[model samples]
Target: MKSKGFTLIELVVVIVILGILAATAVPKFINLQRDARIASLDGFVGALKAANSIVMSKATIVGIKSAKVETNIPNTDLYVLDGHMSIKPEHIKAAMNIEGFMVTNYALTMTRTTFVYLADKELTMPELRALNCFIHLTRSYTQQDGSNVIDTGDLKVNEFYDGC
Candidate 1:
């Protein structure tokens, strides 16, 4: 006799194989979030570096790179931080000028140099730890204020993506 349908044992075996495949696939899918977060932060870092270069070039050309504004960055109130060789953490919005970006988490710590950001807003503090999944940007002290930016190795961008 020819079987018109799959036997119960065959169906069970197929289901078990599928279950194993699904189990493996689930982990890969879950890891996609981590990868996405990393990529996003990487992009952010690139954008930040590009903005720094632009500010640096403008500073070099126009002779304005301090924490104060000698002249606006063509059209914005961005006072280039030549001291840190980057814009102030507070001026990131003005520097990047991306639409709908709210870097509200940025604030000067007590030392007024280091700033840590969650990078991914969807992440919660309790999910891991605040410091674990943070992207840190540190600005070193410089002598110039309202002056042009020079390459002094003052900008430090570090990421601790342990919990991401």
Candidate 2:
């Protein structure tokens, strides 16, 4: 009588095929987290722009145009520099959800304000920036003759996610 069981070679071939399929798929799965982080950063940039728009509209309505004037959006503890939406944590948090995010550094003056991110709160700003996974937002006043302030609302945004 002929045996019905499969030969060892057939089983080994099946296992080899499965191994090849796994090898092809593993890398994609491994990069999902990175992709997600990068996408989130994109969304974050959009939110920042929206917040700035809101602040600008409020500033116009409130007539907060003086270069030395503090940005005052009523009913929020948030503040900006020179009537522009600053990169302050409080100012940003007012517009979007930043549950797990942490700010590494923030500085503000009458002429400019900057906000830098620490991808991880435990990591130093330099470490996070070296990984190319940080955001740097700056709002500054523009000068016409390198002396006279012409515009008080220019925002510069720099975001990186190569090492997300």
Candidate 3:
């Protein structure tokens, strides 16, 4: 008699192989989310830098305030472009809604400077532990020594903290 269809054993074997392949592939797909997060962060950093430079040169302090999502992109606000720069507002929204970003001020000058320190909202406890992931940007610059410089202002990405 000729076999009419795949045997039970053969079908079982095929199912096992498919299961193994799926098991291996699922984790990789899950990890992709983390990669996306890193990419978004990188983009945000670049945008912030661009915005800072533009505000420092061509715009005023009010220009920096327009760096929010609502001012630029409505609703989702994943990206905010203004002052000759585009920033990912979604990062800030994520940080705000998810508590993933924490803004800290590095007082280089006894008073507040034009730049604000931005970083991952969720940092390790003790504050000092998370001090490394800081990004600095100056929206305002003063002319000193016949040049425009942040001088007492700077931005940190915290990723470069402790030689990271």
lDDT of each: 0.60, 0.65, 0.44
> By the lDDT metric, which is better: model 2 or model 3?
2
Tens-digit lDDT string for candidate 3 (55-142): 4343334444344222432333333333333223343433234234444444455222222223444443346344433344333335
Candidate 2 per-residue lDDT over residues 17-84, each given as its tens digit: 99999999999987997777767777777877777677777667766644354565667655555656
- Residue-level lDDT of model 1, residues 6-100, one tens digit each, is 99999999999999999999999989988887777677778878887876777667666554422465556565654334445557766775442
Candidate 3 segments whose C-alpha is farther than 4 A from its true place: 60-151, 160-164
Question: What's the C-alpha lDDT at position 53 in model 3?
Answer: 65
Candidate 1: residue 84 lDDT (0-100): 33
| Alpha-carbon deviation at 149 in model 2, angstroms | 8.4
Which runs of model 1 end up more than 4 angstroms from their true locations?
A: 66-74, 83-86, 97-102, 105-131, 142-153
Which wins on TM-score, candidate 1 or candidate 2?
A: 2
Count: clashes, candidate 1: 6
Q: Rank order by TM-score, top first?
A: 2, 1, 3
Top-scoring candidate (TM-score):
2
